[model samples]
Target: MKKSLLTLGAILSLAVISCKKSESGNKSVIKTDSTATIVTDTDGKIDSVSQSSSTVDVNGKKYEKTDFVYKATDGTLVKVVFKNDPKESTVAITSNKKTFTLPKAETKGDETIYKKDDMTARVKGDSLHLEQGDNIIELKRTKI
Candidate 1:
């Protein structure tokens, strides 16, 4: 029985080693597509942004005027009109259908100042600081 089993195992090993997978003459490797396509939908909407500026003649020199918008405390809208010639600018506060304009900044520095008798306002970057007799408030900057 042992001799028969050894002979059967040897024959099976020889059969596996001698068998070469039948190769057809037309056998070739075909590559699969590994790329994908992407689609984007905008719902037929597009936005356009334009540069806004106005030209002003100052002492025979042209100066461009631009307005930067910001939001103040108490939900008030503050629009600051800036000129390219000088560092002078004005802050306009509109609330409840009433608009008040602050005087042009007198001091020159990083912060723009609007000063009057007792009220002083400063605008630096997106910060709005206001001071009166005994009241002081700061506003946050907003983009439009």
Candidate 2:
């Protein structure tokens, strides 16, 4: 009786292992849509541009984040890094060699606005409209 049970267990184990191998054979490697491009701002702050959107280490914990690269009207690149916390969201806008971290001010329907001091950013779909002092910057998201 014991010999029969041992044989049955070995067969079951082999069947499970073979099933796993078959299931894994058709799996493909998925790539991240986001890419990282480290840039230094005027304030000397380094933004690593998070490696991936779904996997970003924030304060030692994983959080959902996305980094966007936009093409300005003059062809300059505007990097916007978004990090979300449990309570609020933050947007770090680096443009024209300057950078500012703006907190969530309010959400107006489809547009979410961020503000800090004299800087303001309004995000609507693929457009990023930013205002600083007397200068207004308009950008559309582009592929990096």
Candidate 3:
């Protein structure tokens, strides 16, 4: 009877140990939409651009972010980074040897508009439109 009780106790102990919870209990998930384009202004308020699969670590916790890039009429590449936080969003445009940092833009209906000096950038859907004085440039998304 004693041997049988000891065996039962050991089995119960093993079962409890096997069912222990995992450590940390923290999980992270990242999702990206390649079809979405982000646009912002060029006013020196924003500095850096974030990558599409960029990971930010805060106190050992990971967060996900995204960015967008456009081609200017001068053939220079323009990169726009996005930040997800309570503070204002920033935008930085890099073309050749010139870089313009801008603030988060205001939304009007389905369009986002950013303006600085005499230039205005409008992002609508997957297209970006830039208007300066009498000239207007339109940029569309291209898959690579």
Candidate 4:
């Protein structure tokens, strides 16, 4: 009886450990699709406009970005100068040398800044991030 009880206890412990390992092996999946729009006035009227999403996996790497309008403290859309990729480049796992900054405005306003080196903001996984600079705002897909 003592031997049998010991064997049962060992088996139970193994099962518990296996379950934990499997759970950790699994990855969390997040899906998003949404829209962000911002309109700013020149002068000291509006100083900033900005928006971004949470960490998401794109083309296998983790990535996230502010929404259409990332406002600065000065009430300016400094980060959102460029709405979309004019080059119409494809969104893939590979990195592109292209970089963009907020469009220069005549008014005294803030600019939108993109942190490209942030690893948590990188795109990952079999999933792909499309252009339009539109991050997953809502859980929907664009007509590709």
Candidate 5:
């Protein structure tokens, strides 16, 4: 009887620990159809030419996040990067009908900030190109 009770206690403890680990291991949610909007922050105004829409789709079965692409009014292709884990993150921009990938790190939170250098693509004289896969988006920049 004592052995059985001890075994039961051990099992319960293991279950509790497993649950806690699962909760902590994956703190991020599966983001789908995430919209990229441009807005002015409290500090000052931005010079973005026009607002464009960007979408993110987490491919089913593969369970991987893909790149999101946005075309600004000035022909600058924008990409979003993961905020939490930027080191292994990527930014893909489709410019001139060609895809350009950018090297970046992943970050977290809704209000995240990103830069152009983080991409695998190039930002030359008057063009910004990004590259990414079907669903992987490059850099997601927030002004908050």
Candidate 6:
């Protein structure tokens, strides 16, 4: 009986530990998402825009930008700029290296979705989700 009790106690302890680990993992994910808030300076200007760690290869070289603008693998120019207001932020994606501005993004819940024609750009939780027809791209935030 004592051996059975010991075995049961060990199982319960293992279960409790596993539960705690899973809960901590979930909390960490939540924290990582929430920490990507818009950074602003004392003068009310956007200090730096949040960006993902996604990289695109142009030609045979991989390129990643830390700024608000960059060029994708297919030579599409992409820009993400802050507008002080979360709802007013903009995401512009143009091909052929042409310069064009897109309308401000529309906020839905915690995400900003930018839709133009068949393209969709969703910015949320330190990640960028880009979808064009059947092609989907996901970019995670760059760690400091």
Q: What is the TM-score of each candidate against the true structure?
A: 0.47, 0.57, 0.48, 0.20, 0.25, 0.39
Poorest 10 consecutive residues by lDDT, candidate 5: 135-144
Position 78, candidate 5: lDDT: 59
Per-residue lDDT tens digits for candidate 4, residues 1-144, read 999999999999999888744554436766466665443445535324333334556566655443332222333222221232332212212213443432312222242222323211212211112234444321111111
Colliding residue pairs in candidate 6: none
Per-residue accuracy of model 2 over 1-144 as CA lDDT, tens digit each: 999999999999999888743555545867558665565545678744333354567688666666778888999987888888676799888877888899989999989999998989999867889898899989888754
What is the C-alpha lDDT profile of model 1 across 46-87, one tens digit per residue?
312121446778688777665555566777766555455555
Per-residue lDDT, model 1, residue 112, is 75
Query: Which residue pairs collide, candidate 1?
Result: none
Instruction: Compose the digit string of candidate 3's lDDT tens values, residues 21-131.
Output: 868464664555657334343564533433354657887665545567776666656665545444555555555667665555698998877777787778776567777
CA lDDT of each candidate? 0.64, 0.79, 0.64, 0.34, 0.43, 0.58
Residue-by-residue lDDT tens digits, candidate 6, 1-144: 999999999999999888743445654455534445465645787655445434456676655433454444554445554333223444555435654344445788888887777777887755667787999976554433
Per-residue lDDT of 80 in model 3: 58
Please report the candidate that would top lDDT against the real structure.
2
- Model 2's lDDT to the true fold? 0.79
- Taking all chains together, the TM-score of candidate 1 against the true structure is 0.47
For model 1, what is the error of residue 128's alpha carbon versus the real structure, in angstroms, after optimal superposition? 1.4
Best by TM-score: 2
Tens-place lDDT per residue, model 5, 4-106, is 9999999999998887434445557665686665545345675353434334444432222333344555545555322223224444444466654444433
- 132, model 2: CA deviation in Å? 1.4
RMSD of each: 21.1, 15.3, 14.0, 17.1, 17.3, 15.6
